[model samples]
Target: MDASSATAGRTGRATDAASRRRPLIDLADRRALLACRPDDAEVTEAGRRLKEAALLDFGIKESVVAAWLYAKCHYQIPTTAVETAAVVAGGDGTCLLLYNPGFFTEIGLGGVRFVLFHEARHLIHRHLYAEPELRADPVFTLAAEVAINHVATQRLGQGLPTREVPDGRGGVTTERVGIDPREIHRSYRADLREQGLEPLGYDDFVLTDLTIYGELRRMRNPPVPPPQLCVHLAPDGEGPALDDETVGRVVEDALTETMRAALRSGGLARDEMLGLADRSESGGERLGRMWGRLGLAALRGETQKTRRVEWWKRWLSDTLASKLREGERLVYPKKQGAVLLALGHEPMLSRRGPERTKVVVVALDTSGSMPDRVVDWLTTLVGRTDGVESHWLSFDGAVMPFVPGERVAGGGGTNFGHVVDYVEGRLEVDGKRFEETADAVIMVTDGYAPAVTPQRPDRWIWLITDGGDDWPERHDPPMACHRVTTGDS
Candidate 1:
């Protein structure tokens, strides 16, 4: 069916007297209301259709990123809790998309797609640019809406949500359901011109989210008010307040999972993921930092500019955390475990025991090529981590045990095989036999020596220095390798 006819059918069934009688609850009571399910069948059906159209129609066909994100959420609740729609953090460390059923019905399928896409983009925006000061600015809020809607219109081919309304002559006329960005832009242009200030052309005005925000900040009297339809944009007490950390964790998990799926699929989805990474690189520093955490820039064969060394450090810390925590399982409380045992089920327990200390071998190439700063940072990180026993080695054709921050003299050729052999208990260093099986082996080098696979290749993590070769990644059985870009180059 065509757009209008399909919308009319949904509208006809959704606008019955009973459905229209559904009371609108205050945003402050959103949590309580969302805790309960919709009683009206029409409302429930409307919610289902809205979700289906968002996932199947718009998500799969238009934006695979959306599809993966919505699928990751797993909960699209239809209720009278929210005035419009919102993506809020759940207690279980996930996110939920809550939408008002009546509002969905009023907007129809096309509007559903637009609203869903807008909400998804909001999560990403929050994830990328998460400065409290930026979010607090009303101008920034409006700019975000404009940027999101611009992408929506360009991608979904719908500028604004429209619905048929009856005229006095008994004929239907189309009326817009949401804010029009072009109208807002016109107002901004006119206001700036009246104030004798220079206004950017439309093309330059909506270039990026930050660009729009920067332009809007120059307005003496901003033409448009803050967006009222976005529940997320509502002030502190005006709507459901979400915990920033929870939202960040949820969005990060979703985006990471989406990138993994996209890479595995390797088609349009992967292209879209790469495009997103590329855009993030130019979008802003915070955004670029976020994509760096996901390690998507490396997948795109791009090196992240090291504006701050903190990003790569964080990435290495996180990677090390996972590597060190391998073979650990989540532990349930004693009481819970007993209850589950009584019910004929196995009890889940914590992954790491209280007394278990992980062993790690860190090999640094000291052939006069590795940076001193990288070694200093690694020393600090390893020293700060609890329950870890680290073995530091400085290598140059031969391996020597060295303490962090100590002066080591080495000028010989590089040999990665020597480091691997030492870690695997083959080559003894300083006439001592290394017996402990390390949980993780980290090699920081310029990747100059020949690649040698360790006894347990999976346990090895390679950090390639700037202007270095990444041969380990192209080996027969590829090892995990990451490029450390210090922005010094």
Candidate 2:
């Protein structure tokens, strides 16, 4: 969360509306550590207060949230002085809170809770498991830090962490611990103005995980992060400090509880959490995902301005929504045997109830001609549809299972045979059935490739794009071939 800035470039989508978020911030070191020791009473008191603060403030009184520093970590060894607080991983992949109790004690209750909550968000955000490419960029790290700290500051309602420090001449004065997002943005603007370049506002500056990095790159001599803060962000980056899956699950569960508590109290935190569901693409997507899992209702409570619409989006939404709705059916109200017994005076059959769930595979012909709109539509459609378990695949010349949140790199080629080969059980790769002869297979393509036969022709849905071949429509055994008119209407 709290990482220093070194200029570099990276970015993601600027949703038509708002932005995404991250967490952490640093504070300047206070001379209070001179009295801090493993046996110091202040250390004991500080730890006790941290636990009380979380419980009284946000009800986050579990695990590291309530544990004292020593309870969860080792103090500085002779070789290392952990400046502030950090989450480190053990060999077995578990997160431990490592903090210089002296530093935490000095920050006081407000500051300590701020840092504690910030570190907690980092786990939930999965910064420790960031992609290698994202971790390699110093700018992205800084941006994440900025976005997180900004949210922390706003949510905590504390201006910033300022420590009373000892001046060299036996004088004391206030010094800020970590860099403030606004302070840094101001610095960038000053430099930009000298170069005749316009500067972005603070909101736009920390728009996404990577936005900060790109904007900072524009600055001549962008600020470097202070070493005294955000100690976890050294070269190794926020390394895997825990079993990512288990820790992530626990963190999300805790967050859900926190959100519920905040919502029950009816405050700014609740509104902010709800607003996230309607803002940036990433935030909205995350909210929608969590909503489906948690069954949290976030339906539109008000109307909004209109924006450019994608035709395929509406089509896919309606189609998938309809697929999930069950139709009326007849059933024997009594037990089957009882119904049979009653009718058996006449020897008749019993009735049944209906339940439906289907297996669906979505394949994409990701040749050079593949469109982004097409991919987005399908991803949203299948990924969010109820009652359907979906598998994604992108094929050009070879078959490959598509991983969500990853870009599908396509070569200049097309091969429907690979898809059909796997779906029909005619092909097996890596000793595994690439597919299980799914109940339905939807393939989206420009349809310029050769036609291939499917084991279940009746279940294949071919969506051909404009200005592309439609050979499936006239094939010997035609499937449902529809024209996917992907236009911005």
Predictions in order: lDDT: 0.67, 0.54
Q: Model 1, 253: alpha-carbon shift in Å?
A: 1.4
Clashing pairs in 2: 22-148, 23-148, 27-177, 28-177, 89-241, 93-242, 93-243, 344-347
Score every model by TM-score. Answer: 0.58, 0.46
Q: Which candidate gets the maximum TM-score versus the true structure?
A: 1
Displacement of the residue 61 alpha carbon in candidate 2, Å: 14
RMSD of each: 11.6, 22.8
Tens-digit per-residue lDDT, 326-349, candidate 2: 342112223543454355321111
Q: How close is candidate 2 to the true structure, as a TM-score?
A: 0.46
Span of ten consecutive residues with least summed lDDT in model 1:
1-10
Worst 10 residues of 2 by lDDT: 9-18
